[model samples]
Target: LHGCSAVTYKLSKDNTTCLIVETTATASVSYTNSNRQKLVATWPLGEAAAISGQCESETKGQASLNLTFADYWVHMSFASSGGKASLAGIELFVTVQNGSRFLSPNSTGGLLLTASPKLPLSADTEHFACASELRLPFGQPGGSALVLSATKIQAFGVRNGSLSAKFATCALDARSSVPSDSTTAPSNTTAAPSDTTTAPSDTTAAPSNTTAAPSDTTAAPSDTTAAPSDSTTASTDTAAPTNGTSTAAPPTSAVPTTASPEPPLLNVTVFNSARVPCLRLQLRASLSILYRLKSGGNATVKVALPADTKASGDCGNSSQTVQLSFMQGWRSDLIFVKKASGYALQHLAADYRLSPALFPNAAEPNANRSAFGNGTYFSVASGTAYYSCRSAETLRLDNFVTMETRDLRAQAFRTDNSSAEFAGSMEQCLDDTPIDNVVPIVVGAALAGLVIIVLIAYLIGRRRHSAGSGYQSV
Candidate 1:
């Protein structure tokens, strides 16, 4: 094991390993296996670690794994290549009987078997795991977790996005053996992120060669330009950059839409919405009610004003934008914001003084009451709100806010063969591509022609006609 230390188990940069004896001086080390499996030699091998060679006389059917020195413990890990590889004459294999497995040593933790294999769990998720905070380290490829903390149904780091972690909990160690070269960006976890992320109208048109397949992705607005005439108005214009993938974007300015006849008492706050670790933009402002767009815009939002009142705006992305209209007398949480496309928004529900997000009725289809509990495997449900508004309370809506609907996904459990499905998570715009109503647009356009013909004919006929003037006037 000492010679193997320099290259293997060093864990400096490359984490490669093979099944090795804990000590180099240890007698011929051998083990039985049913398949060709990759073995890993780990640093800080747990307590006593030793392995006996199957070829050795006294240790024919026995193998031990202990550290190189006395009082040192090392971890043992080996993948089975088909042949049964036994540890201390016992088979060390992974199998799922009732959705889980057994913990080794059988000390403080125990294994959990599904309640009844005859009636297996559904795929769309019908319940929550009964465990909590179960620590699971990464195992080798295709290896599953040994049921630890059977009472609390927690799978190490993976989250089940739904309210319950039943079908949502994932197998242990899903990361690839070779990590990606790309730098990992840590997700935002601030308690209250601000709402300053809207950008002004896109002035730049699509760059040349945006049509063909290209590396830089972005497109331009098909028809329209930045109206230098209207300095107060901001449009959410999509310009061609290259294709649909340019990293450089216009500066964040308020994208104004046609204003409605609403007062300024409304709040436009973004809710943090979900608890899963996601790559979402976080907002700090606590505006009021939020709505989702059913169609149109490429994350381009246009909030129009009624009287051209000079209302201040702010953006909450990468940097904080303070409100020019910040009034200390009024609570800052009273701004209305709608869910627009292209961007994401996040805020705490309490910031807006909103209602407690009502959890789905556990009695309903495929619901689990145990999901919101405090143990492992627990989670907030599909639409459950960590905070809720008081009954008979109303939150005023102020203006449009930015948000992305791409990440929302959902699935239903089939009562039949049992398979988990991928249903997108859009409370609105499930399939709202506007083109869904092609029949209406065509019908409306056809009816619109009669009015145009009548107006043109009336104006032409009313004009004075020159009778016989061409023949005599010359």
Candidate 2:
């Protein structure tokens, strides 16, 4: 929790525990590299463009690993299977704009342990799911070490997928916004679920069991403004009302009332913060997107959230970000940045940067309620798609396809089962830019055509001129 990002492993005992970024947002917090050990920040002339690597060391009964994130943070999880223990995966990805660069020195090969490794957890857990969050800096290099006579653990996995994060941040000034009277509240305090991966039973686990009491979604985004005199926000979650309605009105800003006019610029890109690597995020305006076409092994992915944002309808300004804790599966609060748009949010309380959004209940989906609340909706578009990634033009190695090709879509009428559609959709979606350096290519193609036409015209003109001169001389 303080320094390292990988799970702890005790070599003395034959026990192993891996950290898995299981897509759960609450409770995962990693410390920063107060002493920049993972990267060389200072630069001379051209000693090196950028530097990065992984370090893992095994001690007597345990192993020590150090990871560092430069700017943005990362997410990870831990899980155990067989006689081995894995620290789970903490993945990091960066998307550079046209002139920008990400992972300038993107390298993945890591130092391995000399001791006998542990076994991986196969799909025989009896449906036991380990959901946790591990937050680390974005530029932190991932490190793992195995001990002798120690159980083996798999590195947290990362794959390509179709998703991007929308960040909303708000401050819960106090808990007195909502009244306890039951009649004025909606029959359901929580948002109604839509058609998604699993049709959660009608008796969905109450959201209150997962986080603090819900905040008024109708309040302004900046309601988290001045700290209240009794600013004691409930640390634990209170049982939510049966569909209680939030009377709070939302404002456009997320900062305090006395704050300046500049809004909090949101960075919506492909973010991988977990035990397993996820696909690269493609940020298009306020919306970020990814798509996975297939999966060979198990590609269980969830961009574990640290916190969330909120904007109450009653708030004078509508554009606001209220931070809330992110909850996995069917248990979590869902808030819409705006009801007219489909972008939504799920709070990840574990994330240090987004701790403000501990609980927000009144917010609902903007336009696409089918997307439901804030959690990233996981589904299969064409096949059992595993995640792949591409930040702009560059592709991620974790996303490279090693299996046979199938599900290739040539034409709607073309029957091509031999090709993998997943490889094309989710897997290949990240770096499938058919046109690279389009400007030059287009110009080159046009220039080549122009040259050919000009050459032909010159030849034809010479022949005609020669004929005319001969006729005049005759």
TM-score, per-candidate, Cα-based: 0.16, 0.19
lDDT of 1 by residue, 382-448 (tens): 3211111111222221112221112222111101221212222423332422456788888888888
TM-score for predicted model 2 compared with the true structure: 0.19
lDDT at position 149, candidate 1: 22
Model 2 worst lDDT window (10 residues): 395-404
Candidate 2: give its CA RMSD in angstroms.
26.1
Lowest lDDT block of 10, candidate 1: 368-377
The CA lDDT of each predicted structure is 0.20, 0.21
Candidate 2 lDDT by residue in tens digits, 1-474 = 112223322111111232211121211112212242233221111111111111111111122222223222222223434422333333221111111221232221111111111212222111111111122222212321111111122232211221112110111111225322223334553211211012111122111111111112222122122221111122112121111121112222232112112112221111111221111111110111111111211111112221133221111012112222222221111121222322222211111111123222212211111011112222223322333323222111111101011121111111223333223344344334366688999999999999999999999999899888856653
